[model samples]
Target: MLKVQEIRELIKLVDQSNLDEFVYEFDDCKIKMKKHKTETVAVSVPQISTQAVDLAPQATAVEAAAVKQEVEEVKEAPAPEVKESSTTENLHKITSPMVGTFYEASSPDAEPYVKVGSKVSTDSIVCIVEAMKLFNEIEAEVKGEIVEILVKNGQLVEYGQPLFLVKPE
Candidate 1:
């Protein structure tokens, strides 16, 4: 069982992240939270046949308001497709596979793997995404010339977010 403050903290963390849903279970308490497309959070703290949360009975007005405030602070989700395709027609986007920090180079002193006007093949390494202390190399899946770098180094990137634009060969 989690205290109200702890639950509030968890809610804020989930809201700030790129995750669409989060679930937690400890002992007999089960909490599931999902972010909706309408800028609202749908939370479920289920009580199964025998698995009931003890915190439900203790949820006071103050706690509820605090949790609601935390949820309300979440950033809005990006527009579905209106802002992406309008200007990027005929260009291939190299997107991040996982949420992490984007790095243009292997090391701070090293040169970037790809830059604008740089030619690349199907397997060329475009950047690195550092997640959970592991560095994962992102590849240019399309053979092309780099036309734009969408994100800056050290910026946090969401899953499926575009990192580079390529003009196909």
Candidate 2:
């Protein structure tokens, strides 16, 4: 699994470069990309963790949590410190309010709540986190431009995890 910083760096590189397509492969995962004609960058994410496929729909809440915990244990590693610009010092972090499955949209078929360079207000729902069969809509605590999305869709996130970095206008 790639660390959060690794993903962020990849996004930054994609935005800065002239290339229109990028692909990254790992032993357990693969990320493919292409430029969105309407936008400068587009991200198509697919995470194929063997654990997710093995999870049975009839699995109990405890079982689902157990699987999530196991994946978290294997995936969450200390990310390297990114060298932020002086302006980055002014960027505020939007953190998870609870420990649950972090989702970038309401459902698998829906567009993400926010994207890089998307302008948003404090009341906007930035993401969804499902816990105990309840879907929680996470709001943006600050109004700003979304500079980065730290976590991916369907990712299992912990409490106080950095979900997004915003550059306040």
Candidate 3:
């Protein structure tokens, strides 16, 4: 049986990610979590054995009620639409090579490798992306002047996600 804390942490991770659903199965246990609308999470545990597991007893009644209430409240709320900025239409994008945490500088105290209006060549290191405790130097493959930084420092970035907008030299 999965612990309540573990389930909560998994829900939090799914909430922060771009995934719509998460599923885990082991032996006779299967747990599925789905994101409904915005800011709402719905958990579903299917019966895998003759003796079904009781997850309610694992968590306090109050905590379970609160989570249910929050889910209901979010369900009643409307989802927001996302639109791209018109200013970035003509700019060339520098995308992330892998999914990881983005960092503007080598270290917290160091200056950013590149900024808006900074000139860059194909070989220039623009930022670092840390994945599995390893920091990788991301290069600006296109020679250009950086016009915009799309991602903030220390933000979670996905593979092929646009990190910067450059004006080709």
Candidate 4:
């Protein structure tokens, strides 16, 4: 029987890679993973006759009912306010290309690639984002001077997350 952690790791690997489908077979156990356009990965595990692997505890009827009630309560709640930054109206934002850990420098001991008030061109590297052990250099993409750094070193950033704000030259 495969551990839950192992299954999660496999899903992560498939998500980071370009493969559309992945399959693993062992003795009497078979695991298959498929990626879909909705950003959902489906995992299929055949039933093993040897022993029951309890991946998750089955929810009780009472607990399921409670969850449904909570969902209804949340639907009645008001939406939260979103604040827009007026200062960035005329600024260009350097956004992350992928989900990964942001690095201000190539290495911990090295100076940061760019900082506030630093002049940059379209080809200038503003930072590095480490995804699946691969360090990818992120470009400024616009000719400008960096006015603010939105993300800190070693922070986890998501795709399209603003890393820096720049005033275009």
Candidate 5:
């Protein structure tokens, strides 16, 4: 039987890679993960676990959160010929410090704190994340331009999930 933590690690690997499907058999249990181009990671445990039968569904929920990030990256560069060389290496990702609902503005009618092409300093408030009825302001720890918004307004975000990609100054 595989531990729950081990299963989560596998899910992360498959999400980061381009593989469409991943299968692993441990003991009498078989865990499979399938990725659809337009959807989140799907996990299926066809075989029963000798240790715990109830753990299957929990693993599915974990994999479901793999990403809304699969929504194609929004690139700022219009130059189609720009090579991949050292482009992403210089970028900094502003990730969610906690799991919550991501909001672009304090109020729904207010303007967003930042947007693509907007410049930011380390102390700049970029967005707000609401968790357990508390609203937390997220900052741009790195000085840079907002190159991409990874999650949509009102979207649910997980801890350590990339919220924005910044081209550092």
Candidate 6:
């Protein structure tokens, strides 16, 4: 969990400094803050490492169990569509339009919005980048099939960071 003061400080930093993104690591916690250039006032704060996480894992344990079940279900289900691997040279890189924390899903308990080999359009939501409490949906600018995901889930991403490599259809 993030503190309100921290978010305020991050937003203040962005407004006061020339830097577009900020990252902080304290003990067991890591916080990433970023602001996109598109929107007038957009702030995202994605907390990757939870230092103050409660040791009582009842809620978390249950969620993990559910996820395991879902994994089993996927294994039992038919395979998804096969997609051709896009060459690096031919790939049109999908980059982060803003500097924030990159998230594969809306929340920890949810499935990722997009994956490698997934078909996507220009308006497809590839992922979400969170800065200051605001979650900004990142869209694919070009129509194509996702070939490779450059960043890992919950990873701290900088401005103009390469998020995915798409093969244009």
Global lDDT for candidate 6?
0.65
Report the lDDT tens digits of candidate 6 across residue range 1-169: 3344344435444544666666766555454545444443644332221122332333466644554454344224332222335348788888877656789998899999998889999999999998766899999999999988987887656567688888899
| Tens digit of per-residue lDDT, candidate 3, span 100-130 | 7899999999999999999999999999998
Query: For candidate 1, lDDT tens digit of each residue in 136-165?
Result: 999999999998898889976767888899
The global C-alpha lDDT for each of the candidates, from Candidate 1 onward, is 0.71, 0.67, 0.70, 0.68, 0.68, 0.65
Please give the distance, in angstroms, between residue 1's alpha carbon in candidate 6 and its true position after superposition: 17
Residue 121 lDDT in candidate 4: 98
Candidate 4: give the clashing pairs: none
List residue ranges in candidate 4 displaced over 4 A.
Answer: 1-83
Error of 3 at 19 (Å): 9.1
Residue 145 error, candidate 5, Å = 0.4
Over 1-169, each residue of candidate 5 has an lDDT whose tens digit, in order, gives 4554345445555655677777776555676676655443753222211112233444564543432122112112121122234766788989989767799999999999999999999999999999767899999999999998888899767678888889999
Between candidates 1 and 5, the TM-score winner? 1
- Of candidate 2, the 10-residue stretch with the lowest lDDT total is 44-53
Selected candidate, larger TM-score, 4 vs 5: 4
Of 2 and 3, which scores higher on lDDT?
3
Runs in model 5 deviating more than 4 A are: 1-86
Instruction: Give candidates' CA RMSD values in order.
Output: 8.8, 14.7, 8.5, 11.2, 11.0, 14.0
Clashes of 1: 0
Superposition error at 129 for model 6 (Å)? 0.2
lDDT of 6 at 12: 45
| lDDT score for candidate 3 against the true structure | 0.70
The residue ranges of model 3 lying beyond 4 angstroms of the native Cα positions read 1-22, 25-31, 35-86
